[model samples]
Target: MTAGTRGEMDEAPQQLPGWAIPPSEGFTAADLDRLPVPAHTQLIDGGLVFRSPQSAFHTCASYLIVEGLRRHLPGHLRVRREMSVILGLRQRPEPDVCVIRAEADRAPDQTAYEASDVLLVVEVVSPDSEERDRKRKPQLYAEAGIAHFWRIENQSGRPTVYVYELDPATTSYALTGIHHDRLKLSVPFEIDIDLTEIDAL
Candidate 1:
């Protein structure tokens, strides 16, 4: 999808094949490091999912959120992009954006941090990633007990921000907000953003 500025993202529609048989061996955290970073690929569910490169608008929006979160959040919060987070020994997801408390970011080495170390996870919805971002990922993050999950759809002339608080009962997330006029996020970071600026990008 191509947008002059920010318009409703023209997401590429593709349904993931239903699971029939489980894999004999799932990937581990160590496997992630061994797998070379490709041109446009991410590790998902013990598999390498190929994704298209992010668009200019998406990249800008991600940067905007990171900067805003950093500026508005307390000293304890750390904002990052493309950070490898290990939800479990068998699960390592490289989220587009993540926020972890100061202490969690204190690991002495490059080992991927665990989900318990993450406070929030954010994904920039791209044309080809509608399902993964809106559906698959939320479930995974929720299962990891992440307190906050955000989906930023930058295609809409204005960015559509979906805020969720993990629900323990369903092991999923409940949409806590739908910010149409502007972007407002209260968890992890207490900040409000004007969608007009996101669209103008």
Candidate 2:
């Protein structure tokens, strides 16, 4: 209301780009679609998280898992790669691979699936996302009640799969096994994949 106040406002620095600012309460699941986020953008705890460029190891491991899973999936399940799963209003994460209920694939235009619709979510570890791939994400996925999860670590350029199952009583994941060289699992359906398959990539 005062001339001095108006002059100060005019002299102030210009505002930052809208995307550069973090909302007080962070972004919502819907913001992922409404905003001009880059490819593979994720919403974590209401914060926007962008993905780092993929490494050869990441690409190879993802391919091996996606194809391997697809081969063994029951008719009721479908395999999708790098798809977003909506865990909550503030949590929309794009797992490296998701084995979802076949019914969840309602249309080719669908951008995401509800957490409940996902039977398994696999995250192949990356240098930039170690913490998330190892900890934060699995926690959210468990809380969202995804039945099975696998965290693939790059061990000496080979994919090492760490599988987990959700423990509903505690709302957390219980590590079931650490697989190397070969991955064999029966839950969520039977599948045997030679981890060395990545070597072909």
Candidate 3:
């Protein structure tokens, strides 16, 4: 038996021991939940993708974004961190942050948030996650009909947020604004975020 990286098993699917079943056919969210793996694993296109451990900087940035949203959003809207959002049958991804509608009818035991319940999805770009955050997730989120998407990028040691709003007619995102130090938005609600505090951490 060979040990893999810290969070993932190194053995190829077919090479796994007798006790381990290969997801050759494909994997579902339920399959991922049952597997003996660490946290932060996601299913994309029926395949398992284990995320790399987040750095201190990444964690701090994520926390700052969540805090900013929570402080400004109305009481009816809720913000969550690292919540799993089910995009479709084959995709379940956990974004860095999510803004969702508060509903009395929502099941208390629901395993994952439905795409329809999400008002916005936020991704903090780490060096290893730039492509997925910038390209892949945006496409998937837009297609799933999530109304808003925010991507936070670290440039020269400062965080800059790029905001996008979905275009229903095209099912794509239109760049609404790029913000540094402060973020102000009028859609879904009116709010402003001061980013300077994030840099101090």
For 1-201, candidate 2 gives per-residue lDDT tens digits of 899999998896988579847789888898888787888899999988888889999999999998899888899989999899999989999999999888898887888999989999999999899999999999999999998999999999999999999999999999999999999989989999989978888
* Alpha-carbon lDDT, every model: 0.74, 0.91, 0.82
Model 2 ranges off by over 4 Å? 1-16
* Lowest-sum lDDT 10-residue window in model 3: 13-22
lDDT, residue 10, candidate 1 = 55
Ranking by TM-score: 2, 3, 1
Worst 10 residues of 1 by lDDT: 14-23
Model 2 per-residue lDDT at 197 = 78
Query: Which regions of candidate 1 are displaced past 4 Å?
Result: 1-23, 107-111, 199-201
lDDT of 3 by residue, 114-156 (tens): 8998999999999888888999989999999999999998877
- What is the number of backbone collisions in each predicted candidate, taken in the order shown? 6, 0, 0
Using all chains and alpha carbons, the TM-scores for the candidates as numbered come to 0.79, 0.90, 0.85
Q: Highest lDDT: give the candidate number.
A: 2
Q: What ranking of all candidate models by lDDT puts the best one first?
A: 2, 3, 1
Clashes of 2: 0
